[model samples]
Target: MFALGCLALIVLPLLGFIAGLVMGGQGAGLWGAGIGLIAALLMSATAALALVKAGRKR
Candidate 1:
């Protein structure tokens, strides 16, 4: 469920943007690129936080 949620939030939106770009143009590309950047940043932060918590457990 968690994995699915992450994929939906982080992957699908980016895919949408790419598809839009292919079908549309620069504006769609820019929008998708922006979303991809934000999703990547958020996923990176989440991974970092999880690593910290795991490290503290040891």
Candidate 2:
């Protein structure tokens, strides 16, 4: 589960960045990429915290 979350943390934002590039231009794409990266980092951090909490409970 944690591994999958980590994979999602990489893949999801990459997809978003590519989509942004295709749909928009350089500026929009850059902005989208930045947003995607930030979102991914936040998501990954949250997932990591959750996993750690669960492990501690166990």
Candidate 3:
């Protein structure tokens, strides 16, 4: 889960940029940026939730 979060935070934007390059449109870059931002938020949220759950389990 933590790894996934990191991937979301880092890998997503990289992927998005590459995708934009491939697609070649004004909106593509924006869309990629949007997706990347969303992914990063999700990643952080998921990581925080996981941490809480882990603490509770302990």
Candidate 4:
């Protein structure tokens, strides 16, 4: 999950922008950017959660 999250943080925005531009135009690209940002945030949060949950025992 951590690896997936890390990869997604980079891929989501790039793919979103390209896909939006291809599908529509600048306006759609903006929308894609917003959506990608939100998705990235969620994925990163998951990565953080994983780190906390994987901590060494006391």
What C-alpha lDDT, on a 0 to 100 scale, does residue 4 get in candidate 2? 68
Best prediction by lDDT: 4
| Regions more than 4 Å wrong, model 1 | 1-17
**Model 3 per-residue lDDT tens digits across residues 1-58:** 7777877878787778678767977578768867887888888898989899889984
Candidates ranked, most accurate by TM-score first: 4, 2, 3, 1
The whole-model lDDT of each prediction reads: 0.71, 0.78, 0.80, 0.84
Model 1 whole-model lDDT (C-alpha atoms)? 0.71
TM-score of 1: 0.62
Instruction: Report the alpha-carbon TM-score of model 4 versus the true structure.
Output: 0.75
Give the TM-score of each candidate: 0.62, 0.70, 0.67, 0.75
Q: For model 1, how does the per-residue alpha-carbon lDDT over 1-58 read when each residue is reduced to its tens digit?
A: 3354466566756785787699788798778767776776677668767867888994
Give the alpha carbon lDDT tens digit for every residue of 1-58 in model 4.
Answer: 7878888888898788888888999888878877887898899998888789889546
Q: Count the backbone clashes (under 3 Å) in each candidate.
A: 0, 0, 0, 0
Worst 10-residue lDDT window, candidate 2 = 1-10
Clash pairs, candidate 1, are: none
At residue 54, what lDDT does model 4 achieve? 82
Regions of model 2 farther than 4 Å from truth: none
Predicted candidate 2 versus true structure: per-residue lDDT over 1-58, tens digit per residue: 5676678778877777787888897776777778877877887788889988988984
The total number of steric clashes, by the backbone 3 Å criterion, in model 1 comes to: 0
Model 4 lowest lDDT segment of ten: 49-58
